[model samples]
Target: MHLFSAVPRGVLTLLFASLLLSLADAHSYFIVTSPTQGTQLQNGAANRITWIKGLLDDIDAFDVEMSRLSVDGLILVARDVPAGSGSFNLFLQDVPSADDYYLLFLNSTSGVMFTTSSRFSIGDSSSNATATEPDSSAPTVTISGGPNPLNDFATTFPPSANGVAMPGWKAIEGSKGQLIGLFTAMMLCMAGGAFTLL
Candidate 1:
């Protein structure tokens, strides 16, 4: 009997399950917000930030902060606020000058945090937004409680001898291109002995 065929049906089933799991999607690690992405904000506008409920399975209630739009880590647009029930509003009392700002969401329980993909402008201030030297005295945001291995969160795991990915490989749903590539590979693998004689 061929070695592949001799493999027990139960083992094959386990292999299939593992393969399926590797294809499963991972957690959405962003602060879901109400402001249309890239929308210019009005001075003193109503900014609504929401927690992505059920993300990471058990985490909820995060502390939110807005960075004063700088690549270097020294500027906060606003102090941190609690997002209870996964939603909260930001009232710009002083009416910040129109400019791009990055939002940070830190999980209160785990200290896990995710930042906005890019800076979002406050009102129609992009053209008027001027670059200023980042203040050396500004507080730097310290990130903590990241994944066991930060690379593992964004990278797909290698296939094991049985052609199944190491336990927790999952595709990030936000990345459409990578997802398509993964799907293509998934199909090709099934056809190419990854599941031979299945």
Candidate 2:
């Protein structure tokens, strides 16, 4: 017996079409490429936060947040940053000097964190030994939601042998190839259905 013989032709068509659509709508992963472990970022300086995309299409925008090991909350650094930009300029003028500062990249549309940077030092501990108050204009949010986004360090690709994160497009190409194969299979199924009707 045929595997899909029991299923109606219209139902099978809809199922295959929906599967293709879902694959087509897959979101890309953003990997932070800068401020890696042991890196130092000076406070009051315009530091650049860069990232690379992985697999499928990029999201419209994402939010950037700064957090510290000693700190108890997440600080909003930037919001609605365009995904295509691939980088953001962060100014920590009012932030204190800390060696455990890290960045978080969150999807702006869904408020879900996608990636994070390793803990790095911020500001010169010798120059600014005391903790400085954050900027009054900057809004702060407490971590009271479901899971802590800080603990989630999700990535599509593993670090290279040198411990540096590198981006690859092979996964994207593989996904495209799979989609094409599925499309071809769907066409064959339709043709088979037409022949059965004759």
CA lDDT of 156 in candidate 2?
20
lDDT of all predictions: 0.45, 0.61
Candidate 2, 1-198: lDDT as tens digits:
767778887787788777766655455457788878877765545456677885445455566777777768766556666666566555555456668888888864577778899888876534543333333443332221212445432212221234333457755564565667577778868776674775
Model 1 C-alpha lDDT per residue in residues 26-125, reported as the tens digit of each score: 5434546544456444443344544454344333233454555443342333333323344444444343444556666564246677545345666432
Q: Give the clash count for each candidate.
A: 1, 0
Misplaced by over 4 Å in model 1 are: 1-31, 71-84, 108-111, 115-118, 124-198
Off by over 4 Å in 2: 1-27, 125-198
lDDT of 2: 0.61
lDDT of 1: 0.45
Models 1 onward score TM values of 0.42, 0.52
